[model samples]
Each structure stands twice: as structure tokens, then as C-alpha cells.
Target: MRIAVALFEDAEELDWAGPWEVLAAWARQFPEDDVEVVTVASHDGPVTCAKGLRVLPDHTWETLGAVDVLVYPGGVGTRRELADPVVLDRLRTLHAEETLLASVCTGSLVFAAAGLLDGRPATTWWGLVERLGELGDGVDVRPDARFVDDGDVVTAAGVSAGIDMALHLVARLHSVERAREVRRYIQYDPEPPV
Candidate 1:
């Protein structure tokens, strides 16, 4: 599986990193899975993220070539990118060619903007549910789901929830046992004190 994590200006780091960690660990521990992960940007070179994190992309949309899965991360950037023709066109093209498309946090808004979530049950950062619903007329927005799996597209709510979605993807693609192993390897037993 070749997974491309789409990065853009102001993208939430964990939205992409959480999944990257899970899939990358699975690939490392179980080499037979053959999971290849890379970060791609709409343009070449560096992107400054929402919280001031800078990332140099591995490839650009024009260079990423034949990705099996594409993970779009959400952040403040999505607010502006919701109507960007370049981003929307690229996503539409990828949706046609990619086997699966997943989004973390507000990334679902981008999918919604591209018409991928029309009549599809999906989730996003809780606060954005109303806005997302507005983007897709028939969108069945799930404000509480950690993530919604609608066959070809999967959408995750808020930041840390992405880890759950990534683990789910592991189980979906491999086995429950494999997902457990990856989770254990990451020591991801979350016991939040809030």
C-alpha cells in the first residue's frame, strides 16, 4: 500500500502524523505488508503548518504518482482551502484513481467541498459539523463518531481521534490481530486525565 499524506499550509500535524505513525510502524514490524508512506504537498518544497511546524514534502501532487491511499489532514488551512480550485481538482482526480481516501479532523471539509461526501455519512472536528453539512447538502454529518467509514472514504473527527481511525484502517486492511500488535508497539494506551 502506498499511502500519501497530503500536507498544506496550516495543516494540523497530528491529523497526518498519527496515521503515519501507525501505518509506518506496521510496515516496519510486518515488512510483508509493504506499506509505503510519504508526505505530499500541492506545490514543491516546504509548508508552514498551523502551529508553526515546518515540513518539507517528499513529493508534490504532480510527482506523487499512483497512490493507493491518500490521507488529507485538517487544520485552519481547510477554512481557506475549501474553495481552492487547485486543491479541489487534485482531490477529485485522486478520488478517481486512488483505492481509498481518508481524512483527519477538518480534512473532511475538503472532501465535502470536492463533492466526495455527498449523501455519505462522515465526521469531522465537532465544531465544524454544521459547516460541513452546509458544504454537502445531503451529507449525513456525524458529530460524535471518532471516525466514519463509508467504504471508499473514511473520515475522522478532531485531533487525537485520528489515531483511532488509523488503527481502524490497519484492521480493515490486514487483521484485528495486526492492528492490536501495532497499537501495542506504539504504547498507545491512552488514559487521558481530562
Candidate 2:
């Protein structure tokens, strides 16, 4: 599975890192699966994360290949990304290609803005569900589900939820046992905080 993780200026670090860590572990555990996880940004160079951390993209949006899955992470930049036509257009393009879409936290706003969440059940950070209603009717905002699976599109709530979503993706793509093994390897079985 070729997964393209999208990053832009001010993207939340954990939203991107949580999934990346889980998936990177999955790749390490099952090297034969050939699951590719590459970072892509609006531009072709380094991008600063919401925490002021710099991340270099593996490819530019225009050069990304056939993506089986697209992951968008939200950050302090989301309030501004709401008006970014480039990000919205990229979301449109990825959705049009029928790739599995996933988002963490306010990243759902990008999908909502791109019209991809229209009539699709989804979620985001606890308090931001109201803003997503503008995208479509019957969004079925879920504040409790760590990750909501609505077929091709899966949305996770908050930052750590991305880890759960990644394991979910592993189960979906491979097997439940494999997902369990990966979770065990990462010691993700214990929930320390509510």
C-alpha cells in the first residue's frame, strides 16, 4: 500500500508523527508487505511543523504517484488552511482518484472544505466537530470513536487517535493478528490517560 502523508506549514506534529511511527513500525515488522509511507507537501522543500519542527518532504504534490491512501494532519495552521485553495484542490484530486482518505484532528476540516466529507460520517478533535457541519448534511460527528471507519475514508479524533487509526489500517490491510502484534511490539496496549 502506497500511503502519501500530506504536510504543510504549521501541521500538528503528533497528528503526523503518531501515524508515521505506527506505520513505520508496521513497515519494519513486515518488510515484505512493501507498504510505502512518504511525506508530501504543497511545495518541494522543507516545511515547518506546528511546533516549529522542520520536515522535509519526499515529493511534491504534483509529483506524487498513485496513492492508495492519503493522510492529512491538522495543526494550528488549520484556521488558515481553511482558506487555502491549494490544499483543498489537492484533497479534491486525491479524493477523485478514489484513494483511501484519513485525517487526524482538525485535518477533517480540510476534507470538509474539499467537499470530500459531504454526507460522510466523520470526526475530529473533541470540540471542533461543529465546524465540519458546514461541509455536508448528516456528518454524524463522532466525539468518542477513536477512529471512525466509513469505508474508504477513516477519520480519527485528536492526536493520539492517529496511532489507533494506523493500527486499524494495519488490520484492514493485513490481518488482525498482525495488527495485534504490531500494537504489542509498540506497547500500545495500555491506556495511560483518558
Candidate 3:
């Protein structure tokens, strides 16, 4: 499976990195699975992320020929991307072509902006849940889900939540055993301290 994680200027690092780590670990541990994880951007260049982290994209939208899945990560930049017709149109096209579409944090907002979440249950950063509903098209915004798997489109809430979503993707795409193995290899037994 080929997974393309979308990168953009001002994108939240963890939103993409969390999932990348999980997926990359899976690929490393299970080379037989043929899982390829790559970061894609609008252009083939370095993008300055939300917290001023520079990320070099492995491929551009033009070069990412046939991606099995697309992972869109959100950030402060999503506010601007929400208004970009080009981005929305491209996302819509990708949805039509890709087998599965996943979003992290406010990435769902981009999906909503692209009309991908229309008439579907989805989730995003807690603070923007209401704003997501306001986007209309009958989006069933779930305010409490760490992630919502509504068929082809799966949305993860906030940043760290993306790791959970990625593992869920592995379980769904491969097998429960494979997912568990990947989790074990990554030592991703989360115990968040309040």
C-alpha cells in the first residue's frame, strides 16, 4: 500500500508526524507488506510548518502518481487552505481516486471544505467541532471521538490522536495481528498524564 501524507506550509507537525511514525514503523517491521509512506506537498520543496519546522516533501501532488491512501494533516494553515479552491478541488479529485482518505486534527476541515465529509460523520480538533458543523452539507460532527471511521474517510481529532488513527488504519487495511505487531514494535502503549 502506498500512503501519501500531505504537507503544507504552516501544517501542525504532530498532525502528520504522529501518523508517519506509526506507518513508518509498520513498514519497517513488516517489509513484506509493501507499505510505502511518503510526504507530499503542493510543490517539490521545503515547507515551513506551523511551529517553524522545515519539512522537505518527498513528492509533489503532480509526482505522487497512484497513492492508495492520502493523509491530510491540519494546522493554522488549514484556515487558509479552507479558502483555496485549488486545494479543495484537488482534494475532491483525490477522494474520487484514492481507496481511503484520512485526516488529522483540522484536516477534516479541509475535507469538509472539499465537500468530502458531506453527509458523513466526522471529527476534528474539539474546539472546531462546532465550526465544522457550521460548514453545512449535513456534516455530523462528532465532538468526542478520538477518531471517526466513516467508511473511506477516517478523521482523527487533534494532534496526538493521529497515532491512534494510524494504527486503526493498519488494523483495517492489514490485520489485527499486524496492527498489534506494529504497535508493539513502536512501543506505543500510551499513558497520558494529566
Candidate 4:
């Protein structure tokens, strides 16, 4: 299975990186599974993240082949994507091809703008629940959910919530036991001190 994490300028670092860590670990630990994780962007050039982290994508949209899954991360850049017809068309094409679509934070908003979330259950950054609802008519926005798994389309709330969503993807694609193993491998035992 080939999983592509879509990157763009100003994308939140953790939104994509957290999931990348989990998925990359799975690919590394279980090569027999034939899982490949890669990052792709609209262009071949380096992408500057929201916090100024530079990333060179593995492939450009034009160069990428068939993908089993597509992970779209959110950030200030998503606002621009919402208005870009090229981005929206590619997303629609991927969905039509039955690729599993996952979004973090405001990434769902881009999905909404692309008409992918219409009449579907989805969520986004907590502060943007109302905005998501406004973006798509009949979009069932879940404000309290860490992530909403609506079968092919999974939407994660906020930034760090993407890690939880990624773990869920591991369980869904492989097994709960495998997800547990990956969590242990990453030592992701979160206990917020706040």
C-alpha cells in the first residue's frame, strides 16, 4: 500500500509530521506489509511550513502515481488551497479513485471547499467548527471528536489530534495489535501536564 502525505507551503509541522512518524514507523518495522509512505507536494520545490520548517517533498503531484491513501495536513496554507482550483480538482480526482482521504485541522476546510465533505460527517480545528459548518451544507461537524472516521474520509481535529487519527489509520489498515505495537515503538504515552 502506498500512502502519500500531501504537503504545502505553510502546512502545520505536527499535522503532517506526527502522522508521518507513525506511518513511517509502520513501513519500517513491517516491510513485509509492503507499505510505502512518502510525501508529495504541488511542485518539486522545497515547501516552507507554517513555522518556517523547510521540506523537500518526495514527489510532485504530477509525478505521483496511484496512491492508496492521502493525508492532507492543515495550516495557514490551507486557506490558499481552498481557493485554488488545481488543488480542489486533484482532491476530487483522488476521492473519485477511491483513495482513502484523511485531513488534519483546517485541512477539512479544504475538503469542504472542494465539495468532498458535503453531507458527510467531518471535523476540524475546535475553533473552526462553525466555519466548517458554514463551508459545507449538511456537513455534520463534531466539535468534541478527536477525529471522525467516516469510512473513506477521516477528519482529525486540530493539530496534535492527528497522531490519534494516524494510530487509528494503522489499526484500520492493519490491526489493532499492530497499532499498539507502533504506539509502543514510538513511546507515545501522552500525559499532559497542563
Candidate whose lDDT is highest: 4
Model 3 segments more than 4 A misplaced = none
lDDT of 3 by residue, 57-172 (tens): 99998888888899999999999998999999988887887659999999999899889998999999998998898775999989999999998899999999999999999999
TM-score of every prediction relative to native: 0.97, 0.93, 0.97, 0.99
lDDT of 1 by residue, 73-146 (tens): 99999988888988888888888876699999999999999999999999999888999999986999999899
Clashing pairs in 1: 10-50
TM-score result, candidate 3? 0.97
Candidate with maximal TM-score: 4
* TM-score of model 4 vs. true structure: 0.99
Instruction: Return the lDDT, model 3, position 174.
Output: 97
- Which residue pairs show collisions in model 3? none
- Model 4 error, position 178 (Å): 0.3
Stretches of candidate 2 off by over 4 Å are: none
Compared with the true structure, what per-residue lDDT tens digits does model 4 show for residues 69-143?
A: 999999999999999999999999999999999999999999999999999999999988999999887999999
The per-model lDDT (C-alpha) reads: 0.92, 0.86, 0.93, 0.96
How close to the true structure is residue 6 of candidate 4, measured as C-alpha lDDT? 95
In candidate 2 the C-alpha lDDT for residue 101 amounts to 93
* Cα displacement (Å) at residue 43, model 1: 2.3
